[model samples]
Target chain A: MPNNGMGTLLKTPTGISGLDEITNGGFPKGRPVLICGSAGCGKTLFAAQFLVKGITAYDEPGVFMSFEESPSDLTQNFESLGFDFEKLKAEKKLRIDHVRIERSEIEETGEYDLEGIFIRLNYAIDSIGAKRVVLDTIESIFSGMENMTLLRSEIRRLFTWLKEKGVTAIITGERGESSLTRQGLEEYVSDCVILLDFRVIEQIATRRLRIVKYRGSTHGTNEYPFLIDESGISVLPVTSLKLDYKSSTEIISTGLPALDKSFSTGGVYRASSILITGNAGTSKTILAAHFAMSSCKRKESTLFFSFEESPDQLVRNMATIGIDFEQAIQEKMLLIQASRPSLQGLELHLMVLNKLLEELKPRTVIIDPISSLITIGNTNEVRAMLVRLMDTLKKKQVNALFTSLTYDGQSEYNNSTVDAVSSLADTWIDLKNEERNYERVRSLLIVKSRGMAHSNNRHDFIITGKGIQFTTSNKK
Target chain B: MKENTTDVVIIEDKLELTLYISGMSQKSMEAIRNIKWLCDKHLKDAFELEIIDIYKNPKLALEQHIVFSPSLLKKLPLPKRTLVGTLSDTEKVLKSLGITTEK
Candidate 1:
């Protein structure tokens, strides 16, 4: 949807990370955008970030008119986010005007309008030559005044004046029970509307942002998950909408020489996904560790996400199988990230993985027992999350290997996670344990290998001090 | 020293008032005209008046808690009162300010 030559509406970049990309550029330029949300949903933070980023990133001066908080309080609150309001004001890049209206201080006698606020705002904007403006929760004027008709007309005039001033503005409003804003400010601001929602699903609180309307520009309509950290708000856009990834033809080993010989190409495709499903103690983590070690041996970066074990525990336990993750980590070739599955929701887990993949740029990623994620979400959510994860990894050309656990007597054939991931993965391997002569014997089988012929027979394997060993000879 | 004597006379009357307004808006101008006319007819030579444009002195607006434009503040004579709107209703303004107008 390219807007070529037909007088595409210009947009002012909101410089918030990932927000500009979703809005296709940003809010409609020189127009007022209404952001409405319930209490403590980050509306004020979003507005502040927009103004601060305008000053720092785009070299645009801004004015912040707060109807609720004082200038000193605002400066003190945003100081934690590293926004030096004092410094910005000293440099003449920012101005803050606080409009204090007490209901008990004034009496309505006759025909009055809200011209004082408009005059103050105009003065602040003109004083700094601001290119951006934010009116945080202007609906307080409705509560402070007794004349509804005059206030409404004055509010309407204020919005029109903002547009005529030719400066990009953000107006934050409190969410109402029925309407988008408590005062229905959304009706006055017609250029764009964004809604922020915070909810607790399964006892984990997650913040989501959605663009309700954009008059003339195309935008992402889905609810994008956003995180508030030390750097401020970041919305994670789903990267799976388009399937335009370039597939690689290079082959990479599966760590075991015998396992590599099973495939016709002597290895898996470079950027393909591999899923390993088995019962408990069937050496799934051991196989994943071996794969990670092989990727590290090639001098390529690898990220290992462990859900059931701590990093120290994984390092110590992998040492029993002769896999030296400690050395690889010491050499700066491997990064082991371990987190509890119940700590956050499935989407946050995916976001963390996405964030790690972006920061580390690992050539190979291994998630030890992704089945633990199923406990945090329903079947469909986990499936969708995995699909998205796989798409992101493939688009980044990062080979991924995931392990899943099956219950006793369920077998890898009938498990739910196996059914979900086996089809999505390009290479599927199953490990099983059987009782023979009062001992549990482990075996491996290549269930399905895409674009290549693979061995169909199951090979007996053992986990010893030197990693996994195949009892049979390498045979195609 | 004529200006000083006039100031002394105004202070002797003990009636001080301030009008907060935006610059030259129609409603503000009307309010100013109406208030001056009422002051001349009712309190003649007994009250002192000051006009402030909030656009030029926004900090003063915050200090006085001026929410609406064309607001009149009766600052003197204790028990302060505020009247918001164009001062078109002379009777109500006089009653709120405890000023007895001669009919």
Candidate 2:
């Protein structure tokens, strides 16, 4: 396990994709972690994924003591995410114990402790030599039992026994209105507490996860946005990399020869971020498409994220400008991921992009009109997300180009999206449509290019059938 | 099977009960004492009780779907009833078994 120079607290390294990074390694090893959340907030899924990942990735056997769902239901639910619990159980690598307590069937007679649960868990753990254990929503026992004092004491004992047994455990509970957990289970499991929250801001559902507390271990305190998809729960720990990403001096063509001549390096830095801001229909997507095509022409893979247009529409529309994205896509050199900005939250979009970047390993990534993402979140959130996105792209040494649509009469710097991205970009290009002699004349200006003496002249550019053609005249 | 038949014969014409416990915890010990006292005072030798530790015989506990410790299961009665607790409340225990005791 990799410790982030913060004391030598032994960590467990929960093999869930991005969770370990956020936890600074994982849950404190051999200690119980309380995961509390409201209903439908993915608490159970997070716990299940933790155990499943433990078994598959770490080769550590796990025991899942579920008080809410049955064994079959759990298996079926996780099966859709590609976790075959049945097969894991058959191999003796996993144990599923469903402790059902019906209020009607169970009649409490006198002073009793919940030793039965302990026995069952002990038996299951011993049988498989499990190193990971999950008691899904153990707070259900509170509703089932009438004696609060005995239940509370037994719960405390259960945590101590788990620590003595030396297994990493996840005990889930329902979130309380004022307290961390409904039954105040947080008081018992004092080592670590994680809160999962699901909220709808502007009618868009966003799931966020926060590490409320982790004793003796340093962890990221920010609320990380998580997503539950086909692969399971993925908590996107934004930009775990430091700012020491190696910048490349290698120059790459922007596909427009005359426009490329405006930069001192003759082209953009290989891994630097480029921002192109212009009003709508100023061929922002066209410019982005040309960059993608240029990368594909060099045999380097390119990923084009089109938020406004479908892949087919983008392909057909770009074909009119003599840029053939379809050929590049068919050649497997270019991957176009077109999605509606309203389909999911901005964090999910970033997560999807992160996943694609890992799987595709593209050399260049282009997002057409990043301004559209402004609708999905507040200004600050969008800016933070973009900063993390840029950090990730830079760390991977992938050349990133983002196009932003500035509203009419608003300067490129005045646009919030452009304002946020320009500060992080290595090169900024401002495009505008100027009405000249009853004709709509398009012009491009190099706003700023770091580490390069770029031409500041506003040159007229024409979008013809052969893509963008820049005039040599420096006149506006 | 032979032992089970012999045990049933001994429990004949009496309230046959099995108490499932997990090890010798205080609660389990208390349940044992309470159930014995209840049987002695209420049934007066008319009830037979067997205490089984689930930790020692976990398979039996799972086979019977007995998930709670300190649970009293009445086996010989026509309608079976399971009351889970330390068995400290003699009145509640008897009432759960559908037995009437002298006030």
Candidate 3:
């Protein structure tokens, strides 16, 4: 209803590009979220993002209480990620207080409570009018204290206090054997839970995040890929069915009129997803740009999502191929966004795409290499994401085109991204780099084109200063 | 200011839970170490040490009712004597139960 406007935006904003949508307008405002992960799994970073994002985006002052590192250490370490902790502290909008739990300094007298911790937290929160609080690795207290009965009671008290204060707190704990936290902290914060995992698959490190639990609101269960960069934590929760949506119905050409004539119903259908599969250095990106250029020429806006290269690099390289991306960009007909796939999780990547699509409302959307995204997620997750994405594209009637890298060496490793989106796409095209004697030639083939009779033969094509063309065509 | 004494007999019974105390909080870790040191030094010989975890078993502590903490008791020792605070003044710890540190 957009009821309350900006003032009523209790949204946490997540500080991450696309996570807010899946979170249904950020995490449950002031409730606690249990962030459990093994050592060196980016637990502290995730907590830092919460505090940083809260201060910058929501204007909701925050306090970060660390039980591990000192405030100076945190500031220096996180400075690389563009988080000026010092600046935030100086502005009095953010406060970071490190509670060093030195076992030797603590003196157990009689009937003592955690008043010291409570006092420090309160001071920090109150100093900056903080609506958000973070207790990083507070479980160290269990080691510092001998009495579990008192410690357990105090932990519960701390949570109750945070709730009463109406601050959205993030309590990070080391992962336990069976329970969510090593200290069984989940036994406390039962409502919101987020689990971050950094696992190595086939010698490649990939970081994945998933909302394990969210109370009173719907959330995407899929594990989205997140990136921890100089900009802090960027979570890619997959796109949700937003209330605001738009559609298109005008079919765009493939930049080549002859190829467009091959469609039975007159070229590619509007809002239909086209899958173009090829190997590295096989003109996949160039082809995608050409298609976007065609859309731009039609005076319809187009968005190019490039993963293999940078936006500037893509523009420069495409200009060499006579694509004229500069003119398209100047005309506001094309937007080229490029970034490394490893920067964030696949879901985060999809979220970025979702935001870009929403803002730009491009008539034609192009993802240069879908294979990179496929590598970040499991088979089922990738399939589900692609189905949603294609559905969104079709509903918007924005003709979607994706380029996928395929391994032709083994049949088993062929077109994993294609295999993911093929069932959902309205058209599928395969680009092959085949060996003919000593000369390696590039060939294009169409596997299937729904609702149309497409050429089912492998035709060789070349990328010159002008454009791409084929000499032979075979069909029945 | 209360003087109470019991029979001078060593309760020869295996404790339901054999709790151990090793590290002393004197110069070691924290309250856990101090508590451990107190338990190790005093509490007589009736409460035999089983498994001493200055780290692991600290969280799984239960059944014996260790509320005040650093306190020790013989669940099987007849007339279970419950004690709190660091086990200093060894003689006082022994005489409180009408027994000597010697087995």
| Clash totals in order | 0, 0, 9
For candidate 2, the lDDT comes to 0.86
What is the CAPRI rating of model 1's predicted complex? Answer: acceptable
The best-first sequence of candidates by DockQ reads: 2, 1, 3
Question: In terms of lDDT, which candidate is stronger, 2 or 3?
Answer: 2
Query: Which of candidates 1 and 3 is the stronger one according to TM-score?
Result: 1
Best by DockQ: 2
lDDT of 3 at A29: 74
DockQ comparison, 1 vs 2, better candidate = 2
lDDT of 3 by residue, A233-279 (tens): 76654556553544444566888765675666567777778888777
Query: Each model: TM-score of chain B?
Result: 0.84, 0.82, 0.44
DockQ pick, better of 2 and 3:
2
lDDT value, residue A74 of candidate 2: 95
TM-score of chain B of 2: 0.82
* Tens digits of per-residue lDDT for model 1, A293-375: 99999999999999999999999999988999999999989999999999888777887898898898999999999999888
Per-residue error (Å), model 2, residue A88: 0.9
